[model samples]
Target: MNSDAAISCPPDVLDGSRALRLACETLDIEADALRAMSQRLDGAFSAVVQRILQLSGRVVVMGMGKSGHVGRKVAATLASTGTPAFFVHPAEASHGDLGMVTAGDLVLALSNSGETDELTGVLPAIKRQGIPLVAMTGGLQSTLAKHADWVLDTRVEREACPLNLAPTASTTAQLAMGDALAVALLDARGFGAEDFARSHPGGALGRRLLTHVRDVMRSGKDLPRVQPEASCVDLMREMSAKGLGCSAIVDAAGTLQGIFTDGDLRRCVEAGVDLRARSAADVMHPRPRTIAADMLAVAAARLMEEYGITSVLVVDAQQHLQGVVHIRDLMRAKVI
Candidate 1:
């Protein structure tokens, strides 16, 4: 038969309702497996966490087939969260990659059946090297578990697969177990968002945490500012030249006294005040929102958001005008 004919299903068999029912059943099975696993947690789970915490080197994760795929994800999560880890394929380890497992490192091997030959083949070498082994598997008495120093039971009653041959719920349980381990380790090490951001410097969280106001604020000649006694024409000229939509009113010592924005200009116009005759202080909004140069750029975004303002001045300890951070500046830096 052609490929299409071989895989084709009857109309009733392939109905949308049946497909949705199957999807719901798969999710329910997996969710139940996770709940059962959560209830089964005991001292063994705590011991595994303590073992990983006490390790001096990285976690070397290994497995075969589908388990290996899960191992790779587990290793990546652990590495990014604070615990250093990497995946080494079990088959490759038997060849020559076993050298990657160093003295102080810990080995986390995953195998649902706990009897993968390629995985079991290297257990003796790992044991002889005096490295600690933690096995995540269903077989309590299997060779893999027997050789392991710590065992994390990941046994599921059945796979989510209809035929019960493919790994579905089992892999979900293993992945959840791996996540639990990483979260526990993260808490124990006091790994906060800033610490997490350091590992992911290119991510959005990193941009928010690592980027400072000084890095994105317009300073020097680019900053729009005028003396409090300067004419309104001078303030308008500075605002237009700098294109920040606002100008700072500073005193002789460059101390920020107030800010005059286009909104203030419109309000003055509505009140029939002549801009040509006014000084900077006559129309400026005193004590405008200000942020420190060392503050996070995200904090500047927050202040702008909270006050419903488009621009804010960066000030020193004495409230001296250092720079101006417009909403556009935050956009250009991708900090907002």
Candidate 2:
């Protein structure tokens, strides 16, 4: 009614509470959409897995607009999880990229409306290559769906957008479906951590899976070693010098006999055992946990956690001392 009243508060301008409420509402819509889609995962879903698993070549994924973006992610997830998938833009596929699709490959095309011109334009070529088509679409009767060998109906009730015009809920549903397909294929292939790490060698997961105890352990001079007959003071000196919180008690032949940790030192002190008079073998833990040098560093971490200890002795098959692997070494390597 007046300039001051008009300036007081704009009806379209959301406050903090309204903003959070709107955000939550969007998430709720997507969550419900995913739930509905999850229920539809039945025989048809299994059929897609069957086709994918039977293939000898990679899966070529194509889509348009927002679907194209989600398709890229789906392709990456599929590839990284051992399915060997890659994205080809539908428009580009109409060019020379269509050659990338071979007879052995399967085409996974995404189109919410199922009639996207860019997508349908390349469908004939895919069929020409004798590539089985798997369509993820809302319209089951649309051209892409009608022509596809298998249809994954990713139909959502509505979009999360207030205007119901954006591809919010539909895209989220598509991504979830892609993840489901990837995980399912991974399981069917018996794809383990080693397979995944091979695909992602530059990441922390790769380090955890590929790095062995010998790769991270302190060997030779860096290792804190002492003869079984060495004095407790000498053991403590080796522990402090190496800063590994423990010393490996080895025999004259360099065979690991025991380990003397700071914890053992404390107990010896509490028991009134003279540190200068006692030998490392007299106070050391005779049955300390040891891991082979060939074991995974993550496995070493697990062994330490299982024993409630800070470090473990690295040994060979003959109980020969190889090195010391400390929890801090694992943390530094980002393998923990």
Candidate 3:
């Protein structure tokens, strides 16, 4: 046969209806697996959570092949949700990485067959070290399950793959079980958004909850402020010098009397008022939108959006002008 003829074949004809039907079938299979797993959860799941809570060390997850991929994601989910955990490839564990596991640490081994050679090879060592093992596998009577202190049955009736040879539904069941464990542990530990934020300082939730107005606000010399009796020229100069687009009108005692922004200046100009003759207090908007310095930066962003303004003054309990936060500051900090 000619090499080109042997390698070439007609493109498979597209069948939109069949494709959609297969996709729906796959989802239905996986959804059914999850529902069955949820129904099968018993005291064993809760015992695992309770044991992990009392553990002083972290959860070390191990697996091979497709199970390894799922294990990595499960480890990440657990770590981010306030459970301390990490993934260790089972093959690597046999190659001296088992030293990473300590007495207090718990092992969460994943293998669809529960007899993966690389994973099972380390069981004896883990047992000798007296480290508790929790097997997440479809194999109930396999070596991994036999050696485990607790067995989480992640078995599925069938794969979502058309040939029923792939790890689709089984891996989904394992991942869902991992998430269930993390959520249960999170609730038992009373882990809240703040705790989750600390673990994900680079994420959106962290930026919103951990970042405060004081952390992003302009203070001291950077804050634009003019005394109540200062001329409008002085106020404009202060605003321009600080580049905050607004100036706070403060009294002699550093109390925030009012705020003057570019809008206020535009109104003054449109009214044909002599800015040079006016004091900061005369052109300022009193009782301006203010936020406490301790408030979350996202809250400051919300105030700016709600009032259709670009800047807000940060004040203390006694209404003393502490700082100024511009919309740009919130954007730069990614709080918006």
Off by over 4 Å in 1: 1-13
TM-score of 2: 0.87
Per-residue lDDT for 142 in model 1?
A: 96
Q: Which predicted model would earn the best lDDT? A: 1
> In model 1, how large is the Cα lDDT of residue 89?
98
User: Mind giving the per-residue lDDT tens digits that candidate 3 earns over 172-225?
Assistant: 999999999999999999999999999999999999999999999999999899
Better of 1 and 2 by TM-score: 1
Instruction: Assess each prediction's global lDDT (C-alpha) against the native.
Output: 0.94, 0.91, 0.93
By TM-score, who's the top model here? 1
**TM-score to native of every candidate shown:** 0.97, 0.87, 0.93
The lDDT-based order of candidates, best leading, equals 1, 3, 2
Inter-residue clash pairs, candidate 3: none
* Span of ten consecutive residues with least summed lDDT in model 1: 6-15
Tens digits of per-residue lDDT for model 2 on 203-308? 9999999999989999989999899888877888898999988899888999988888888878887989877888888888888899999999998999988889
RMSD of each: 1.8, 3.5, 2.3
